[model samples]
Target chain A: MNDTNSVVSIKDVKKAFGKNVVLDGINLEVSRGQVVVICGRSGSGKSTLLRCIDQLESIDSGEIRAAGHLMGFKEFNTKLVPLKDAAIAKQQRDIGMVFQNFNLFPHVSVLENIMLAPMKILKRKKSEVENEALALLERVGLPDKKNAYPRQLSGGQQQRIAIARALAMKPKLMLFDEPTSALDPEMISEVLDVMIDLSKAGMTMIVVTHEMGFARAAADRVILMHDAKIVEDAAPRDFFEKPRSEHTRLFLSKILQH
Target chain B: MSWSWPYFFDYMNNGLMLRGVWVTIWLSIISMTIGLGLGIFAALMKMYGNPAVRFISEFYIWLFRGTPILIQLVIIYTGLPQLGIRFNVIESCILGLALNEGAYLAEIIRSGIMSVDKGQEDASRAVGMNWRERMWLVILPQATRTIIPPLGNQFNGMLKTTSLCSVISMQELMRSAQMIAQIEFRVLEAYCIAALWYLLLVSIWGLIQTRIEAHYEKPFGSQEAVSNSEK
Candidate 1:
């Protein structure tokens, strides 16, 4: 299923934590401009799959490619060897990730948090980076909060700023690991609205969220994972209306009742 | 033989005592500065280095911290000279004190770095930071919040620890007091002046430490009700 147009391709990716296998034979392909939302139970390895794409969690075995490079390994004389930290870091730069907890640097202002990576990693001009950072804050609808600290912001505001921070690097692919999972009920839609706008702008994204509304509204393909495997992959309408897998039907019944 | 008020008052304001105070202050500042650098380097090595590098850091900490600073000072200043490694009194004092201080500070820094939330590292890594950038930009800045209070206490101890160097005839506060007591035979009076001066230095440092702690605690910005306003 991998193609030149695909931004992310995973082949038989597997991962484990000690004796607990997390991702088992997980294969997925996300094309450019595709918005794929992954839904699964808490221990279902949905988050691990997303994390493995950026090498935040190393896979046990498999080939996963994103942004035109292998995730954590390089082909050295036809043998797969793990890339060095600097090399892995360069690969990571092309991919952006937003965490469930937001993880905004509490010591810096919102503007600085957004500006840090582009200036330090990319070595862009400070003035130019500052202007771009300001524009990102504006895009996230928080221009006046440029100088505010992360602790001073609400949970929703911080997550938005986290997204803006990731966007500052201008990543080719963005991964959201339950981005709105930690937000207050009223704040969820605000963060999701920004995400919906991002998806509409043709950014390739893989979001691991239980917010089915997001799946219906923004996702081009909705994936259901269970027992460390992808059990369902279909358009939102078919996945919701005409479920195929026994796991999908069971997951939908459990999810939609909430 | 008596507690001479004249000798006590004279020693407190005398040129020799004043010079001793100056030496103690500069020695503490320079030694503490170098100790902090050594500490940070050692802590990073212990936490992240390969086995060989980590072993070096661990052994340095173990050797220095295992012995008394007084013994360490004597070895560096006196013992090393017989072995063809002769340093002047000031250099020996700094080298000995800094080496001892670094051992203690290394553990303090390691705990401080550990205290920072793990999410900070994850965020930094996701943003494409290498290990160096992650440390200097993200981890250490936050760790400074936890490191300052303990670091202040260490500095307070270091001010008095410099007195140990007096055994080597380095002529800091304690040595100056001993010299005056030897001639004037006002042992109690001269030593009391040195004690009071040490007290004064630590008290000044305490005030400065409070300001530093306050600065780090609110490093982001002032309280302006940004969160309150949002809700």
Candidate 2:
């Protein structure tokens, strides 16, 4: 899976927890500026795959490389060693992730939440991060929410702030894990609008969602996983219009019949 | 039961019981600070440290919490001399209080830390925060909300626990009351006065606890309402 152009290369990754295999022999490669949408049933390991890309969940055995560097290990003297937490933290700064729960820091104001990583981890100046955070707030269409606490905002607005928070780190790739699943039915499109906008701006993204409309409209490729394996990976049109596998066909019919 | 108002006034206005009250307050404050600090460290150790550290921390909590605070005070003050270790009374009192309180506080702190959602830490890690950074910036701040009310209750209990330190002859409020009772031979009256002081201190703490709870509650509740209406 090591290639010159691939931004993320996952080769034969396998992860399991206590005999419950979540990802079984998964292999994938994502290039820079590509938008990939992943859809699957609740237990299909789509979210785990996205989390594995960011090294949020440790892989059991196999390689997860982002930007040609191993995700959770450092090759030292020709031997791969698992990196320390602090070093992995520094390595992970290039990736941005958003969760279904919109886990914003509710204790601080939204501005502080956005500014914390840059100021603390990156050791950037306060005023500098402040200005950039304010700009990010504007970009997310939440200029006034700078002083607001996360719990004060609706789920849609909080998700936007969360996206802004991730963007503040200047990440090379974005991962969304069932981001809008917790929102109300009416609030889904607003968060999707933000993701669509992010896609249009050419941010590399791997999204795990149930939103088929988003997949059809925004995805370059749509990957469908079933029973811990990706059964279909194709262009959005082919996936929706001409899915090949029996599992993919059945899953599509069930999901799209609505 | 004859009561002397003048004698009681003398005990209060003069420095005897007043100084004792001061000693109790100072001891409780110092012990709580030390205990809370140790509790936080132990909680982190139990939650994230290597097996050796976790083992040591668990042993510390288990040893201290398993015994009575009174026995702990006695052992630290009297028993360690067999090992050629000697501590002054004040130091021994502090050690006993802090070690025992730290064990209980460690469990409280651990529970508070666990109450927060894992996604909060995941988000912190996503942004390149190390474990310490995630704790300082994300987990502890949220954990603090759930931690305070129980902490206040613990402190209130600590105030009463300090009475047990009286057996050590630490010149605290209860010790002073006992001394006065011995002198006047009016044990009931002296104890009643001690009871008043205890009631007064605990009542003050109850008020402060209410305020602290309200202080922490202020932002989260209002913020939710505001966020909802803003949408």
Docking class of 1: medium
- Give per-residue lDDT, candidate 2, residue A121: 88
Give one digit per residue, the lDDT tens place, for model 1 in A95-155.
9999999999998889999999999889999999999999998899999999788888889
Give the clashing pairs for model 1.
Answer: none
Over 4 Å off, model 2: A1-4, B222-231
Q: What TM-score does model 1 achieve against the real structure?
A: 0.96
| Top candidate by TM-score | 1
Q: Just chain B of model 1: what TM-score?
A: 0.95
Which residue pairs does candidate 2 place in steric collision? A152-B227
Quote each prediction's TM-score: 0.96, 0.93
Put down candidate 1 lDDT per residue, B1-231, tens digits, no spaces.
668788888998988999999999999999999999999999999999999999999999999999999899999999998999999999999999999999999999999999999999889999999889999999999999999999999999999999999999898999999998898688899899999999999999999999998778774445564444434
